[model samples]
Target: MSERVVPEDSRQRRRPTKQGAVLSEGLIVETALRLIAQHGADALSVRRLGAALGADPTALYRYFRNTDALLLAVADEMIGRAQEGWTPTGDWRTDLRAMGLRIHACYQSNPRAAALAAHRTTGRPHEKRAVERILGILRSAGFPDALAVRIYHAFVDQALAFAAQDAAALALPAAAQEKEAEVWNAVYGKLSADTHPHIAATFPLLAADMRESGYPFALELMLGAVAALRPERRNS
Candidate 1:
């Protein structure tokens, strides 16, 4: 029977709204992400998400027990986006470097979401799949199991850590963000050569260079160190 096919407790049921919209878990998660993007991380909640989706606040509970569950879902969705376009070449170092950058870029695209993901682990299928792919890259590079695992752990942690830091900075209110720039210009730009010779020397470059991310620089340093540890390179 149709009833047997679709149980009474089935949470997959969609509810129509006055705005000619229907609510589902996917829609709820998508709207939550949009709200975070538009209004910053503080924008999310059962009520706010419901309003955005044009559904009752209780309707969201059917899909996700609470906000934490919903945030994990959002994070997993972000990981999926990060991993979607990645295709590994045969070169392990190249692939790993690219992978790091890709994840960074993915998190940057949705800063508030990244901030939330910073402290939580989804332990979900998408993240697991990404892990497998990275492990394959390291193992194929002739790294022993133990070393490969260590490198993978460090590499991922570094990328995510930097992404979160960058997202937190970006999540600052517009006035706050501008204040950082103003401080760098007003303070760092005016250091005296007699009192702060080193800073004065670098002041010209600081205006432009400091504005750019240090993630790529740090990532390359880590990757180069890992590459040198490859068995053939070590023995040679």
Candidate 2:
């Protein structure tokens, strides 16, 4: 019989050797992000993530101590992705608007991941960078340091709060969404025309607002308010 030999790399691949471990911290974080995007934060667990990665569950602990660490890493990754390719335009309103829209779009793109990351303060590098960028925008707009800080706080809180709410809404099953819509429609649709004339008159508009207008509109409104608050430009 002819001698048979297996290629070393092939053997390593088949036997799950740590010699060339395919899984790393970055890969783990990326996988976790995907899981969060696909199955919501509630569905993500070490076992589930390991299964998805085709690696031993304990293998993940080599990179992340626990699910919370993994979640923080995911948050960092989300914020990092949001800031990618962003540049300071020097125009305060334009820059702030761009930053807000980028963050909003990022959350809207991965509602599940956003749901996990939006509210938690990881204080990661990417988040710090985002904060600096926003503060810079306010400063460029001629707001004092205190006012700029306050505006940044409000902007971040509102963005994340709305992102969390939107993610929760999006995570609902279609049937549940329909049911909730129906309940709201029925309850609000039944308001007496005599007693709640305004409600009855604008029911359609209200419902449309509930469905059509979302975080982006709210974000713009917030930015507009901030701009209005900016000290008027002095032409020296």
**How good is model 2 by TM-score?**
0.83
Cα lDDT for residue 41, model 2? 64
* TM-score top scorer: 1
lDDT of 1: 0.83
TM-score of 1: 0.90
Listed per model in order, the count of residue pairs whose N, CA or C atoms clash below 3 Å is 0, 0
Model 2, runs deviating above 4 Å = 1-21, 233-236
Estimated TM-score per prediction? 0.90, 0.83
lDDT of 1 by residue, 75-151 (tens): 98888888888899888878998899988998999988899875667898888898899999988888999999999
On a 0 to 100 scale, what is the lDDT of residue 153 in model 2?
A: 94
Report lDDT (CA) for all predictions: 0.83, 0.76
- C-alpha-based local distance difference test score of model 2: 0.76
lDDT of 2 by residue, 1-236 (tens): 11234343332223342334477667778878777777776545877777877887656656555678678888888888888899988887778777877787778788888877887778878888888888887876789899899999998888778767877777788899898788658898889899999999999888878884377778888878887787777311
Which window of 10 residues has the lowest lDDT sum in candidate 2? 10-19
